[model samples]
Target chain A: MSGTSAPATAHGPHHAGPYNPAKGRLGMWLFICTEVLLFGGLFLLYAVYRYRYAEAFHAASGLLDRLFGTANTIVLITSSLTVVLAIFEFERGKPTRARNYLLFTLLCGLAFLVIKSFEWGAKFEHGLYPNAPHLMSMGFGEILYFGLYFTMTGLHAIHVIVGMSVLFVAWRRIGKGTLMRTRPAFLENGGLFWHLVDVIWIFLFPLFYLIS
Target chain B: MAETAAHAGAYGEGPYFNPETVKPGPAGWLTTTNHKRIGVMYLSLIATFFSVAVILGLLMRIELMYPGQQIMSAKVFNAMFTLHGVIQIFLVVIPGIPTIFGNFSLPTLIGANDMAFPKLNLFTFYLFVAGAALAIGSCFTGGGAPDTGWTFYVPFSLKTAVNVPLATFAVFVLGMSSILTGVNIVSTVHTLRAPGMDFGKMPLSVWGLYSTAWVQILATPIIGITMLLIVVERIFGIGVFDPTKGGDPLLYQHLFWIYSHPAVYIMILPAMGIMSDLFPVFSRKNIFGYKMIAFSSLAIASVGSLVWGHHMYVNGQSDTAGIIFSLLTFLVAVPSAIKVVNWLATMYKGSIRVEAPFLYALSFVWLFTIGGLTGMFLGGLSTDVPLHDTYFVVGHFHYIIFGGTGFGIFAALYYWFPKLTGRMYEKRFAIVAWLTTFVGFNVFYFPYFVMGWQGMPRRYFDFPAKFTELQVVSSIGSYIMVIGIAMIIGNLLRGAKKGEKAPDNPWQGATLDWSLPSPAPLENWDVPPTVTRGPYEFNHSEDDK
Candidate 1:
């Protein structure tokens, strides 16, 4: 894909006119704000339910594997650093290095997802999945807690996968020289999105895994 | 080349000036990224949905005509009303003015060739179509259409065997579409304004869209997540909103209204902006308090988000919460009132032209005033309890949304018909349609206010004998409204086909849109326009017809 010398504009007809980096960045920020609100609603629900059933929520939080959660949090924070470095390298005219950092970010994303799958697998083995017979028999607050746990983390993991795919695309584009420093909005937006995913995880980790 | 010449001959302009050739043919329409084509597509899509929803609404009224399962079973009646609410709110009013006129005119009004992100604009359109399809498709699947009403309040939404998940998912998609459009519009306003077109110099309509875009971006995600939660609860039996699972239904209401309340501004702000532009145009005067009108739109969007709790007045929330929400609701009204006053003051002593568009705008003022004032009744703690679920609440909202935004659309369509179609509608028929619709609308909805005040609960299949007379009256009024709406649609279609060709500047306006040829060219302007005057500068010598 990178070998094609299609003059970059062949990326699509939508890229008409001079690219406005500021507009692209502003649009990304606005989108990030929206993602915050999206997760904010779920957080509001957690807060309300946690307040209502404090003891059960603590017990439910205890059921989560903090080691896995902590490891995933560190992995996400490392990924955030890699994405930032990727942007730094791209802007500093080091496309190969930026691509390598993006690759590392993508790896971290995979690692996070693999760890998440293992954790979820263990929960499923315990029959703690939402509305499972075992979960249905649990205390109401515990049921609600696990319900929110899966939903929130599941949504975050989807974001991680999406962010990884975006980084992969940016990496490929940078290799093709289509996403050079002159046309860096695509890479910048990808980095911003990855950071948002990390920031959301930062919130989710303490709320869901470490609250107890 | 042949197609180009054919359009040139038809439109009296060559390929160099035609906007339609950005793409050509049926395939072109589906794939076209031109804002004009997308806008026209939205008009058609919205009209189709509006027609279906209107017909469904008429069916509901027909059943209420005689009461007690007159034409359909109670279950069918529930489905009809639910679909009606969903369709009208999501597919019609919410997207009404902004997607239609805003898409068509915003870039031109600001002297941009197209939206900042034209591709994203087209994507938003497709999202709308996909959402509408899913919403309508739900009717044929999984125990038929959802009967849980548009709100889809918990406990019931969770228990319904109907396709609540599909419907809610449709809403989620639609919300995404609304947010993306909002982002596109806001970005356009910020980055695409013509040289010298400062924010203050922008048309009030632009300001209206700007404010609405903020609401759409900020408020829509809450509802998007809320709807997803509902889908989650339905599919996974998560107790996020289910009472059996330690969920509080009130949380759903809170989350729903948090977005839904500000969504009211999303529906009406652009319409209000249209009025701001129209009053100055028809009155042949500069808008009174232009800054106030512009600022009020922003104020409305800001304050509107905080008052969602007003919708929960009867939901057993704390009185302190209700009082706070009620006060904030009343506070939101202040900005709305300021706009009304400014519009009226603009028309106070000017040379007013009573055109069809102007007539619709005038009716919007009257109807919206009634709507707004009645809203005060619903906003106050003392009065809302009696009117909470009554027909009064229904009447108030229809007056605001249907009467306000709906007529705002009619006004914009008539005002821009010549510009949009490059043809003049029959003036007399246009006025006739307006008068009939105006009269019929008041007659139809006013009775609901009376009946609601007299204690007729909404969404009921049957009522007592004492309520029979007013129900029949309201039904008759709806029939008249149907005829009037039919006439309006017929006039526009016929006008586009055979009406007289419109001149470039029919209204002698000063906005950048008026500077363009009717059926504005593909790039909107061959050369980017520079603005040296305000959007409502009526005193300019060239505009002094």
Candidate 2:
């Protein structure tokens, strides 16, 4: 790492743009690396609990909507593709095409959220919310299992919403010619983040939907 | 923008004290991309929090003057300790180096014009402020400040009377700020090095921060997510940590410590970096084992992460897990020993000067040695079981955190004060403050180590009269230490205008920071610097003057 401080003696301050866009993108990618570790830590917690209370987790997983989670996973992965394609459009100097791709990605993000709301609604209707009165009534393991699932997946959904908003803003910026030149780092970084969101869902799909 | 105007040299430059030099009040400070300004802003916030927490600490001391709830109710005492922990950990110590000195000096030391992302740097400062606001604001909410202690142990945290969710939310935001700053610095170090300054050629301070930044990036997220989970548990009644709904409170401790223990390294590694810089400069010698010190930082960061379970030895961790944690915990001490030995060896046979920063660094060595050795005593399961959560653990950490990290901060402040403010503080005043602080610090925390060994539990308002004498001495010592703190602040504030002028390189140090004027120009460097002499080249210069 370059020392964060300035050199003691040098000719003049301004150098040819110390801000390299590619490195900027790389910095964001590195940020997601940490985010992955963070989520990985939480996932480890889930895994250990699942191992310890496999019957409970499995039964709890049965309560979650398998079709809804699978559908949302597909929606997110599809959005991830569009984001990549949008970056590709920008790389090829096709701003209009990139805008269309970004729009599609944003739409997919919104759709995923919409489906998530539906799933949450179902859970709420079924008294499956976290720490619901019926939680302990079901059994200790089952309550613990559902608790981890809701906390993990709910937090993941919040991130998706945040990711979607960032992308929507980037989409508008691209159309305004702000991102047309030099391939917007915003679009690139946003794509990386969207992909992370997708990757989290990929893990979530099996844990919440497929395993049971 | 206007690069030329910002790049003027010594006589060619404008007046030494430009009206524009000090950031223009609140708005200028809020929007400042200037690292020095941001450093000052962070220090100001830290000081504010420190003052509040210190008052709370003093009150806790007074409450313990008798035995059972003398001045306040048990509930209030709980809040006091909780406030003290939260303020010290989240508000002050965690941001100790990086936000203050790291922000101000990191870009300057590297011979860069500014941080790789100046705007993002500003955002970090703002984020910290916002988080602090949220955290402190929770105190006034209907439910009152959180009483979960800084650890926010689950079950209690989720079921506490306080508005813990809001407090946890604040912690979440503050954590993000820390992670972002870490990422920014890592990238800055990666992308913005001056020419000829490769990884091995960098200064020790940079090395320390680089390791710290990685810890912040990697470990902070676990804590962030953990805090978020607590909030979720509280708000939505998630059973993740709630005992009634199959949640295990033990899991919360595991997750919390996973980040929190590594966090202890985050707090001290940069300070160690500060000592690494101060030791050689004040000693007027080459560092003893430059690579060892650099690599030990990484060692501490990695090994530190694996030892969080040590905190749980007495808290009900499985014996196998405890053994693994104990082994890893012992491993951490080796790197710490390497650092201690290397620093002492650096001072041997060297032309050492007793400057204020050097005094603090020396104290850091002496006190951190005490802290580290005592830690070895506790690392063994036999001793820890008896003394866990007693005054011993409290004293052990204070020695490390206060004696180690706190002294390191003072050393850094004295070392870089001139660079940040363009003024030389009173040497005698600084020295006097250091003496009292060093003496009072030992007097204060040393007894706790003894009382802890004697089986005095921590956080109790009243104890047996047998422990009273030491408690009284510790309380008196606390006052002396506070006075010392007051003197240090007084010297800095009074010296800002009344002090003498500092040369660009007052210590004649060889680091890149000495190459620039104090209160560096709007832009950092005229051009990126090239490295010629190695980081440890005290003997290379024949002209000592």
lDDT of each: 0.87, 0.81
Model 1: lDDT equals 0.87
Top of the candidates by lDDT: 1
Give DockQ for candidates 1 onward, in order: 0.34, 0.49
Best model number under TM-score: 1
Residue B164 in model 2: lDDT: 88
Model 2: per-residue lDDT, tens digit, B1-545? 11222333732132223446544656667777766667778888898898888889888877876556678988888888988998899989998798887878887676666666778888998899899999888888949977777888877787778888888889889999999889888877877777667777788899889899889998889888888888877777767777777667998898888889999998999999989988888888889999899999999999998999988888888899988889999999999999999999999998888899999999999989989989987888878899888999899999999999998988998998777678899999899999998888888889998899999998776799898889888988888888899899899888777788877678867777776677555566555556666666756542237
Lowest-lDDT window of 10 residues in candidate 2 chain A? A7-16
Error of 1 at B65 (Å): 0.5
User: Across residues A6-49, which tens digit of lDDT does each residue of candidate 2 receive?
Assistant: 42234343332343675577579768977897788678878877
Give residue B89's lDDT in candidate 1 (0 to 100). 95
